[model samples]
Target chain A: MKKEKLNIKAALTLATTALLGCHNLAQAEPTEKDSWEFDAAFLFYSEVDRVSAGEAIFNAKKTFEDEDVLNLKLTIDALTGASANGAVAQPTVQTFTRPSGNGQYQVEPGETPLDDTFHDTRVQLNGQWTQPVSSNLTASSGVHISKEYDYLSLGLNGNLAVDFDRKNSTFLLGFSYFQDTFTPEGGIPNPLISMLIGDRNAPTWDDDFAKTRLGSEDDKTTADILLGFTQVINRRMLMQFNYSYSTVDGYLNDPFKIVSIVDINGVTQDNIYESRPDSRVKQSLYAQSMYHFDNVVLDVSYRYMWDDWEIESHTIDSRFRIPMGDSLGKESYLQPHFRFYQQSAADFYRPFLLEENALPTFVSADYRIGEMAAFTVGLKYGMLVNDGNELAFRLEYYHQTPTDAGFEEPGVLNDVELYPTIDAVIVQVTYSF
Target chain B: MKTKFKLTLLVPLIVSATGCASLGVEPWERDLLAKDEMSLNASPVDSALDDHIYFSKEASSGGKSFGGGGCGCN
Candidate 1:
């Protein structure tokens, strides 16, 4: 009887162990089912004297078997601003007389200031869709449409990505196409005028000059391609590199601006409309790396860029995020940042033009001339607002200086050095759930 | 401009691919990368505002992203 009782107890223990194992297996959570999620945001921004801009954004995403399957994004933006109109004192012709045998004309110059203002607005819409073909393959496509004043643009872009080595290595190919058209605010019928009076009795104005209005209609097309790589060196380090090239073709000039004409006697005459290169090619190489330590994060980046228009630039950016407090509490940090930037001038950049010299095929009096430098400092603070929420804020200031190449005339109009130094303040806020 | 665009696309692809190949992080290591602040553009609104200011005051353009409305200031 004792043996049988012991055998019965052993059998019961085995059965109980088996039953518990099955129960635990049955209680395990089922593999997560495929799911979809949606998110949306609205942003509004305004500049003191410029315009107010707003955007509405919507995003939808879905995942299957723990992998992203599809994503759709849309954005609509609107910008409205008052016309930037200002008046400048200019000389007006009163009359002209020729002196006997002097071969020179005497003229009267009257000063006048004209006042003008404008109203401008624009709207743009963009849509993007992405789909995963396999565990390691994905494709994305996008389209955009915009309208401003008399200008319109339509664009399309697409990209394909393939992953390798368990999603650590990825290869991507992309293409983009853009078509744009522009029409000036005023109808074309304006007349062109010369500074010097050649034939007083003949018609010196033509329709072509009138048709080339400020902000006139223009057509343009652009295409681009890119390649990139990213790597996680260690638990505390990461890095990435990228290369890109692009081409742009079409009317690429400011029709509103005029080139000054000077007489042999060093006197200014009427201004003539100017034109620029119709096409441009640009390329860039960029690399970035980050290192995270126990108490701080160090970031650095470099970019080399060049263009067929004789413009080249090198940019080096670095930042360090250091934790300052939280000795008594968790999740408290403060970071201060600094940035510096510099760039070379464009080929067509010129401070002033001489009357006796032959003008180049393309020329510009715009003052983004020579070399430039900028410095920025900022601070960020982060802390938990509550059990389920966090809050962060950032504030920054920036300043810049002109290069030695500077402007043609130090104190004169179009002189690069005379341009006022830039000063700006930026603030950001973020709340998360 | 065209070459710049191409370079932008090429660089991103090459970097992403190389990163994938060299990455050895376990699934749990992605906690930081999955954070919203890890994105290149932390605030789209602020970025857009900065771009607008730069476009109005400078000669260079097309750094933030693609597709923007036309402005007479240019």
Candidate 2:
């Protein structure tokens, strides 16, 4: 009787364990790979006759049985080719000193000035730790360091996520801070200082002027905070919204950028280093939705951003994923992506300064800060291989079109190409296991 | 200098987002939602690289995640 009772107890325990295990397995989707996982990708970006870049990124993650996770990432970027120097086109051949002040480059008549020495390699490293603070709360923190030929940046961030309403909703709060330093070649240019043109060769070059033109290195700091909410509207749809606020202070000028000092006829007279406000605040609101269908998934997002510089922007992006026939049963799909962006010019944006007008306290000629509309069209395909591993490739095209300066173009300047459209192509390949 | 934060502005936002748990189904009904691509950030690396490219080319950045690895590109 004793032996029979023991057998019965063992049988009941076995049945209970089997029942729970079977149900859990049926309800659980595979979200984590065994032990460790890696993701790596290579990107190629090229702009028509302007700039080109090659970049690679590698990411590794380890998951513990307890649900704690660790992640590390490395990024390497190699950039080469010419970049716009924020100078308007001229009817006559133009020559200007390079950022180094030790050299010069020439632009042909009716052509925009581009600095040909634009080149740099950057490397960044990042690490993050995530763990559950409670059944419904998770915390994550990370640190990143990046270095370039003439720049360095260090940053730290932390985030907290709380699940409510029986895990149907999640609220997240995050903050990050960064400190960056600049060590541009030949030192930082003094704001509003007139640049000496080919001083070593110019007949009227003055040594005294060079002494007052530059300063030592400079730095800047930025702080950002974000609040986010994510909710599952139904089994087939999910939505997320976020609000972000950021502040930046310290030296804000691009040491290499200069503004053209032009005369009444919009003819080049001299060049002066540009200046910008030492502080700025920016805010943005973002919303996204993802919906799944029987054979396809659709994702769409939008963002509205504004800043102290009086710059406002709007962005709309969408992606549609359609699965291929019998391609690992929905594991393989083709995705089409589209994005459109538009921005208003900043308060300090200037295509060129009028020699007769009094100088402003803050000014910049960078076209990036001017009114512009941009769009991107892309296609991506992904397939499953080696059982659960994945391989994907994408190709995209981007175009930027700038609006009229609205300032009257004087003399021959009206015939010059003031705002040239930028066209670029991007290709990428990624692998994950 | 404007648009300062106020609790009054958030009161309605929070109220509208909460008390909607009834919209969800039982735990067993989450099979479809559990798919890997269903996550908000299904592909982190893809997002990161795209952010870097746009940040360098555009005047406005950051409607997504943040942690500056900034460069003097402009």
Candidate 3:
């Protein structure tokens, strides 16, 4: 039986090679056709009063004749700091359950609520290969895996492109699928359950705390499809358009987030885990254009997106690159970028629930699903050396704001700000050869 | 919603139809466009890092590459 299995595997491998093999392999010499390239970058990202992260990435690629290529990449990230727990601030000290639902903590009066137990490291690896099936057709495939302290993700993707109109235009189709597993440190908490703490006045611990499992895991899956077109409109201009659709299912809730419950007078009552729909379908249309002039180039793109969760968004990105005088026989350029984004809230998003209203089937306080807008401004400088090496640096400032959802205001807490502004900065350096 | 869907379908057709006007230049004029600096993604590594950052902080993703999904943070 083992011999038969081995034979079957061999046959399958042979068949796959034959199907994807180069049509003109005999015309190319391996040593003459292959060239190596490498890129490395370090990133620092920080947000006010929230998580901060530092990351580094290294990528290596080998290019063969006809633009065929193989790539390998490694990424590492370290994250630390505090994140909001979606609870409201009040005049009295407030206590809430921890993520594990087994421990509790307190926030001082008139202070924003935050959970400081956020620290983790992540590592991700990716591999991809591209090959030309013919002079006008190409195929590419890739796989990636990422691991964190409480999460794991594995995914695969493939793309096909065909050139026509003398290579002035191309059509592309791509598909991707991913599977993810999550095992929160304290296990997944039941949605909308009042945080358990020892008897109210005695500050005793709940007996059920010991029963919470630390090894439970939840799974999520996502599938995506994209159709794209690229055209060279003029010698100095190019344009591209793409339409993409994606669907996600299973365990869509954030295990660490919770919502505050308020009484008729806006007095804080309890805090419970947030809940959300288990599935979502989303679609987007994107268009991009690039134009070059005597001393500069312009790049611009726009995207419109909507989803079944009743959220809609628009994004615009624009950049201008200006060439500077040559330095030491190397070309140098400076680029400035501006980006804008706005999004509507999801149907189930709320700042806080009222005890007088009917219990909601789905509810969440996660600010990401709330109405918001963000703007980014950045500058980058790059240089190309005589030996074909490249070096670049970028600095950016980002600001995000949350807006009202146009819902009825709570009678007593109408003055409270449900969302706080977030300000962040990013710095990056990249080198390639 | 239906009208938005229709517009999404129509915009692409209109853009492609305009191509029939033959507004493109001859092959020799492509010299400038052939330069690496003129490409849409001149810095692939930098673009990848930017994409990752936006995905983690925002509610929407995609338009460039694919396959990486939600992190535990989301």
Candidate 4:
């Protein structure tokens, strides 16, 4: 009898042990590879260059900026494969033109004033690997290589994430280092001489202005750090916040560009080549919130950004996805988006130059500076194609105008409209396997 | 300027308020939401492309994304 009782107790103990082991196995965390997914896409943009409302104001110049742009991408994810998990390859091609003739030359009678058009192509590759050390901690590292018409960049990034509880909150810390090489096509030249000649063949042009090579090569390094948090306030709302800081040092000039000077009589001409400031620091804070109420989703986000170059910007963005009731025997949805943005101009942003002025180290004639306000309205439609496929289309229009600060002289430099309204259309199709 | 500011604030508030009122749906009725079309960012690639174009042409950046290199476009 004693032996039988002992045997029964042992059997019960073994069964309990087996059950506990199974439970632990079931609750074990998934490997990094197991949670991975791969995605790739191709995108194209064809700008309608010839929309007319009247006698074209500026006889639109046909430059590289007028060409259609295309981008191709391939991303590979190893969910359960090996030490490496994520990789991406992206290539893009663009055609842009360099303006010729005096900056104000009119189209030669019926000559179709298009000048030089050059194709710029870029390719980039990135890869990342992740490892989990504990139930609540994970670490990841990544590397990237990018090459463009006049520049090459190599970068390394690392991140660590911690989950406080499996439930509703998480924290992420990350850092990135970037090293970039800028190599101009014809080498760097004296800014003033290059502008005065307007042609690359001038004998005064010097390739030595470039810090690195005969191609006018310059190198820059940047370091960035980021911290982010996501918290679920309740069952229906989620909020996230992120803060980032970045510092850049070394050569930071645009070698191919020249500064323009405007005389007292309002006549503009290209002058000495310009070099940009060698260092910049930027910081940003962002917050986003989403609420799920029944069938509707509401998303709102805000961002504040500041840079050491005396540029500060504020942005507010929001979107509402609404499912429309059956109006034409089909179910559809409409999503309207709105955004507001304002920024202080860069320290070196100038609409026109003073003849006898001391030139800054860096300057840009680009008009996006000067305070500006923009508004956007958009709509989207989705049509079910099959059980697992759908087609979606989106249309959005935006209009912007300069703000008070942008109009220093009210009627002088600001006479020409700085902001041009834009219209865009987006269409996509998706299939799930 | 005042008009623009009011318009900016009013439009979003009205939309959100109206949207909030009609937010709830039965679980089964959420079939539409379950469909990928209802996602706020259904097409990430297109969004990325649009963001790039706008970043290159306009004066703003950063909304609903992270971790892309900076350019001197602005």
| TM per candidate, chain B | 0.59, 0.60, 0.62, 0.55
Compare the candidates by DockQ and give the number of the best one: 2
Candidate 1 docking band: incorrect
Candidate 3, residue A208: how far the Cα is off, in Å: 2.4
Question: Scoring only the second chain, what is candidate 4's TM-score?
Answer: 0.55
Q: Candidate 4, A392: how far from true, in Å?
A: 3.3
Q: Count residue pairs with overlapping backbones in model 3.
A: 1
On the 0 to 100 scale, the lDDT of residue A86 in model 3 is: 85
How much lDDT does each candidate structure score? 0.53, 0.83, 0.81, 0.51
Residues A1-433, candidate 3: write the lDDT tens digits.
5466445434533443355473443432335355456788999999988889998998877676667788878899999988888887666778876776545788877666888778889999888999999989999999989999999999999999998887888899999998999998778777877656555334335446534332478989999999998889988899989999999998888888888889877778888778899999889999999999887999999999899999999999988998876852368888899999999999999988987777798998888889999999999988875355677889999998978788565544665556788899999998775
Q: How do the residues A1-433 of candidate 2 rate in per-residue lDDT, one tens digit apiece?
A: 5466445434533453364353333323334532457788999999998999999998877665678887888999999999888888999999978887777789999998899899999999988999999999999999989999999999999999999776878999999998999998878888888877755566545464456366668999989999999988888988899999999988888887888888888899988888999888989999998888986888899999999999999999899988886554437889999999999999999988889999998888888889999999999989876656688999999999988758777777888998889999999999885
By TM-score, the candidates rank as 2, 3, 1, 4
Residue-by-residue lDDT tens digits, candidate 4, A1-433: 6466445434543453364352323423323322112223333332233111100000001011212111223321111100100000011111111322222222222121222232345555655556665767777777777676666778888888787633346688888888888765655544334343333454443332232222456688878888887665544666778898878797755544444465554334334444557787878898887767677778788888778767787878777777765552245556677767777876875644566676665665444543566665666555433332234565656555545454243322333332333343333332211
lDDT-better candidate, 1 vs 2: 2
Cα lDDT of model 1 by residue, A308-406, tens digit: 877776666566666656652347667676766676777865533456667667765444433567766777676654443445676777665645454
DockQ of each: 0.15, 0.46, 0.44, 0.08
Proportion of native contacts present in model 4: 0.07
Each candidate's TM vs. the true structure?
0.66, 0.88, 0.87, 0.65
Quality class of the docking in candidate 2, CAPRI style = acceptable
Better of 3 and 4 by lDDT: 3
Question: After superposition, which runs of candidate 1 have C-alpha atoms over 4 Å from their true positions?
Answer: A1-119, A187-216, A261-268, A318-337, A368-371, A380-394, A398-407, A410-418, A427-433, B1-23, B26-34, B39-73
Where model 3 places Cα greater than 4 Å from the true spot, the runs are A1-33, A199-206, A210-215, A327-329, B1-16, B23-26, B67-70
